[model samples]
Target: MAQPPPATMRAIAIRDGGWRFEEVPVPVPGPDQVLVRTHAAALNRADLLVLDGSYTVNPALAAREQPIAGMDGMGEVAAVGKRVPTTSVGDRVMYMATSAFADFIAIDHRLLMPVPLTLSAVQAAATPSAAITEYDALIVQGGLREGQHVLVLGAATGVGVLATQIAHYAGAATVIGSSTDPVKRTRLDRYGVHVAIDTRRPDWAATVLDATGGHGADLVIDHLGGNALVQALSATAVGGTIVHLGHLAGRHAEIDLDQLGRRRVRLIGSTFRTRTREELFAIAAETASALRPALTEGAIAPAVDRVFPFSQAEYAAAYLTSGQAFGKVVLDFA
Candidate 1:
């Protein structure tokens, strides 16, 4: 039998204008929630934004005295609420939820996904947010079809690596990825990128067009916005879709409306920040269903760049900010 949870837990939270460990009350599961004893948590760019007060998905977090600073984690189910029948104590699970930088999280059972047997706790923690984001961007929003040409900007990023792999697993004919760093560009091929373009080159779009035999990409999963987005318009095939997932380069972009209209291109912006609980549940369900086979078989896995002990979370965040990691940065609690 599992031991009862403690009254309080250590969590990384915003305090004194920076991230610090704080003792907070352990959350009690509601009727539909599950209490997970987290073993690992994955750091995302959004965590940085949350710390800096630039963005927040949960408005209530801002009003809290010490807002936690994580988005996803993996652990064992310590307890379950009355209404959550599908999950039980001892189930290994992963989920995307607010306040996940703590040792325990009480999340809706519907939000939890069983960790694939092939993955360790840390790898499982790395998968949920990136996998779900790309599955939605590539399959749902971009309308990816088998034999299509797919392009991913910032392909060395945590989500970018998964986007490339997801496109490849979906049977894309060509997977082209871009990274400004040549060193990172070289690493993309192992992650399912058939052609790696150095975005630093002025003619990178031409390279993409050439690689596609002058046709351009059928679907572009763009992580870099600003000038990169504008250039993507020129590299996109007629009727292609561009799903803008992030703006790591620059947020503002001057698009060429004439080119967009002539090409009949579809530009879409996606984020989980504004989604309702029901909408997120549906997305999580769809993502799990579509990617479970690959996940279970180890055909698709998160590329974990580094693992930091939970105590070194500050260094992990700094490492991620330095652009030194090729994939997801994870914080291991054990």
Candidate 2:
């Protein structure tokens, strides 16, 4: 109802090329922006590299040369500019933020979307980045169609879950996923992941073939690079797609061109970092329609494996690398 105090707020900042938590001025919104008071922020694999001096995707700031690390977050609208017609104070919002580890963020009005009433703050925060990354690859790039089969690598991670759902939503006949853990495997069915095989087992590929009756999946989503590419190549139907989204397994990819050309396969790569806010908003709007029912009726909940207070941001970063969690790991600033 009233303006927040003028004093600075506690934020997780990276300065002197090191990760930190410090008191920084809460950002003020420009004419085309909104100010969000964050309730929760999720850790992304990208967030970990930025703190280690290995990430390079942050928007180049005039005052700061070093990249500020953050990609996904959830918060409430604390303030909005006069020109922003769609949002007002106290509206629970979720969107991409710059250096989202902070308690407050100033972002383009277009990037913020109203959180679905059924989704909690943590669940809302988990959806934007991961959902869009999968959307960009399978729907936009892979040309996934109804009746086609889809295979998603890194099936226990966030994007994998979204891909599995999107494939089913698109009317795929069957959707398969690869996960090493039995616990995580059980969660896939709700998302339309029809058959989830443990990649740790030597027969994972055989299981996919058996499930498809040797016709093979029409599309394969590879968020885990390296040998997963070879595995995708093997499981693909003669002219299928393999959408490359990450290097979770490792960046280096080894493949045989002769084998790939024989199948008329297509390979595409995606990074949501390069896409514009308008682009992201369009996809979110579509997903929002699909997400509303499931989000409200408990068909889906934000798969948050853990949450850490803002003070333990580094532990949150480490948790992502540990690969022990099934869902997202978040930092609670409120």
Candidate 3:
């Protein structure tokens, strides 16, 4: 028999403008939720925004007295609600959820994904958010087709690495990835990037155009917004789609309206922040169905740049902010 969960658990939270551990009550599973005992949690750039009170997905969270940190995690299911039918108590699962940087998290069961047998806990922890985001950006929103040209901006990022691999795995004819750092551009080759460009150069878009025989990219996955958004327009094919997944550069941008109109480009904005539970559930289901095989076969995997003990989360955040990490940063609870 599985041991019962303790009444309280330690969670990472922002206090006095810094991350620290606090003891909080362990959440009980609601009728449709599952209680997971987390082994590891992954960090995202948004976590930094949340820490500094610069971002909040929901308005309610901004008003909270103490908001726990973290977005996704990997763990063993410790308990399930009566309404959760497919998941059992011992299932190893990875999921996207609020307050994930804790010993326990109660999440909607539908959001849980089975941890692939090939992945360790740290790798599993790095998978959910990046995988789902790239899957949705490339396959769903961007409408990528076989043999089409795909471009990923900030290609060495956690989701960026996955985007390049996914575009290649999905049979893109040529996969182009961009990074401002020359070193990271070289590393992108291992993640199925066929063409690596340094976006810092003035002619980067022209280089993309040259690579595509002046036709531009069929689908563009953009993580850097602001000025990059304008450049992406120059690099995109007529009637192509650009899925704006993040704005690590800057949220606001001024672009040439004439170029967008002339090309008939489709600019889509995607985020989990404001999505309803039903929408998130559907995305999770589609991503799992489409990408699980690739994961099982080891064709695509999350790039974990570093792992820090949960107590060193502050340092982890520092490392990520320093722009030295090429992929995901994870926190190991054990």
Candidate 4:
């Protein structure tokens, strides 16, 4: 059934550093693109960064009166462009990118991944951003190997949780996680963490070392930069890898150069902005393929802490900023 989309659809618009619903023209897919009618979307740390003007938006989009927001979405293919070979109208899918806060989005078909039947629209929407990030950090960049010990800093975060799972699935001998919240720390094992340490403790690194039998971790996924980064460096084993994916704690840090040099640490910084469109498409394709089995078999899942109505995006953003939620906060368009 070919259904004609309305001329305009509601979108969460960024205005005066906040979000509000506004009407925007429904986009038509270009060649090699697909038109999606979104049913759900998820919030990310980038969303907060963008909303606060800390992260720059696309120049052309920033010039708009009301630029759309969001990075992950689940939807049905309402239309497929002429050059799109793999996608067809009516297939359920999920994707990762900005400007997904809109009701309908036209995006490159190559970026779309088939939504597994076991997941709901909200769960599907929650997967792309968190999954791709962890896959890139833990597996691709960090080079986690079977039987190696791994540590996930800020383990209560949505990305942190996924990173732990990826490490576990990769056959890590031990998985250590850190969280400031005791309640959140208690839930880390469910995400495949063998030990959860309170990051607030001054002796947190000692606990991690004890858990790993004083060998330190083979790989460290550091979401918190600043002091946490310094601590993570200390916890990393000689010749180990530490992938710095976020600076949620603080941007600036004074690290020990002598120690870093002695440890032979491979510190890698990663972000979506550094990748070109073609590169992102490739990463999306690779990540989707690698995780499809786990996703389809119900072995891995995104931990959604709360789901808000699409119209209540403002509330959702506030909730995300509160830091009370344990997992991804999603917007339900249903």
Candidate 5:
């Protein structure tokens, strides 16, 4: 490959106590790694948590994980390393990295997956991280089975939409979703959501219970923590499993163990970035294969509500805070 251009690339950085845009040295793939020329990197609520130092992160991992503040992106291989024949220069690929909000990022070759020739860069960028979490929480952790009724809270968020879609594909009998905004309710059908209710409404929980004929949901995916968990618990039936995937609602939650005890409820916490290499790759491969058809058919694609040029990353993060987006807010490198 031709020599890389004069070393620097634009990146978003968190240092001291603020977000800054700076020209940092371009990342070069280490042995067992591949370099991605970022086309777009998506943002999540967790970025704010990392920025405010409010999220749980292994300090040791941060040294490997911080600096760049996002976890998903799409890019082409600019270079490759020894022992990494899984990819090559000019090959289009998608992968999640700790600090992905940059023009380029170096990731282990094993972490990279070939992008389908039919998919756009933005679509390829959308699959990693969030989508994988939903796969793990619902497919692996919750042990979802065909014909099960699944309830997805925060259904319009990045993970919620993906989870709902996955559930639909997995043969879920009834799929119900919630959004704080009534406007979001109208679009749930796109993700195959059977029932979409405004969570802010007084009787929304009752609606969910009724939707399932009082037997309650067989699986519940909770993105909003705190009270949402409690509400989900109420909507969950005996022998049900509730997977806690995110805390966009609030940090602390109150659980009535009495209800849990009587019902045999299982609450699981899932984070994609923290899992071992083998575990993540396995989930990614399965979800990728299963969802590929939906993606090709346009039934499942990353919903990009807003696209900000890569330079305007902080503004993008602020936009997420306003909760104006029902889907992902992506940082465009082009």
Candidate 6:
């Protein structure tokens, strides 16, 4: 453990239904936890849900009475609890934790991943949650195989970019991506997306089928749910898998179950919030290990769109909502 820590530190606080920066008490690490001085934090769409109170994090685990919002960050281990054995003080680390929109965060040491020297704090902060989500969806759940035709729906989002790269590295025969943004769609080719389809077109599924020579995608990772999910069924080949990971399109949609049944397509819904702490730690560690080679070789890296200072969290959130960012938006405390 380090010497006695400060009484309070600067943090992005949610008060009166809005975001504001304030000084809050520095959290004490529990027996199994470590105190991190966060250098950079990344925002996710879920953060907006949390802000609007649509997605409730366990109140018992809330960082303060009002709760702070953020999912993952990169920082230095400033202090270790008496029973925390894995991380030492002064270590550079990154981890997914609740209430990370602050200058400091106290998290379970088990969830931590050592930051690779090659990655800047911004790059490392951009990983963790996004990496784990893609690893689970494409590798563990989707069983994406080499030479398989894969389609990434909503491939302009943060997780979408990572999924495209992962599928390419997995040796997919054709990596197709769908995005509503015309400019982003064009850049998808630079990120391992072999074919970029405009989701605005009602016949994008037909285009995907044509790209695969009338054989639909072997794996369809759907980030847009609702009507888009129904369309994904049309893009999936018989016996293929469609991983429904996001509902950005909406929650409900009308679809033909007969088509789903006849095609023998498997639809899976995955979310990290439901995983046990131990399970999440395993996923994080495994993803880090699996991507180390790619990370070291420059085959995979964070596509950071913009960075905002800790005090400008409101502007950052607004920028994310503007939908101009093609990659992860980060909040830098340094």
lDDT values, one for every candidate: 0.90, 0.76, 0.89, 0.87, 0.79, 0.86
Question: What is the per-residue lDDT of model 4 for residues 1-334, given as tens digits with 9 covering 90 to 100?
Answer: 6788999999988888878789989987889788999999999888989877788654322212347899889999998899999898899999986678988988888888889899899999999989998998988888888999999998888888888888888899999998899899999999999999987788888887898898999999999998999988778889999899888789998999999999999989988775766777888899989999888887788999999999898899889999998879999998
Model 3 stretches astray by more than 4 angstroms: 58-66
Could you give candidate 2's per-residue lDDT for residues 1-334 as a string of tens digits?
6568456877766776567777888777888778888888888877777656665563521112223456778888888888887888888887765667777788777776668787888888887777667766777788888898899888778767777877777788989988878888998787788999876676777788889989788899987888777777878888988888887777887888988999888888776556665666677676666556655676555567898887888888888889988768888876
- Best model number under TM-score: 1
> Which consecutive 10 residues in model 6 have the weakest lDDT in total?
57-66
Model 6 residue 198 CA deviation in Å: 0.8
Cα misplacement distance, residue 81 of candidate 1 (Å): 0.4
Q: Candidate 4: which stretches are off by over 4 Å?
A: 57-66
Supply the TM-score for candidate 4. Answer: 0.96
> TM-score per candidate, in order?
0.97, 0.91, 0.96, 0.96, 0.93, 0.95
> For candidate 4, what is the lDDT?
0.87
Candidates 3 and 5 compared: the better one by TM-score is 3
Off by over 4 Å in 5: 1-5, 57-66
lDDT (tens digit, per residue) of candidate 5 on 51-125: 777765433223145476777888877888887866778898777667787777888776666677777877677
List, residue by residue over 77-143, the lDDT tens digit for candidate 1.
9999999978989999998887788998888888888888899998999999999999999998999
| Model 2 poorest ten-residue lDDT run | 58-67
lDDT of 6 by residue, 1-334 (tens): 4566689988877776677778889988888888999999999888888867777664433434547778879999998889986778999988877889988898878778888788899999998777778878999999988899999998989889989988998799999998898889889998899999987789999999999999999999988898999888899999999998888889887879999999999989888767776777788788878987887676877789999998888899999999899989999998
Identify the leading candidate in terms of lDDT: 1
TM-score for model 3?
A: 0.96
Reference-based lDDT, residue 264, model 4: 97
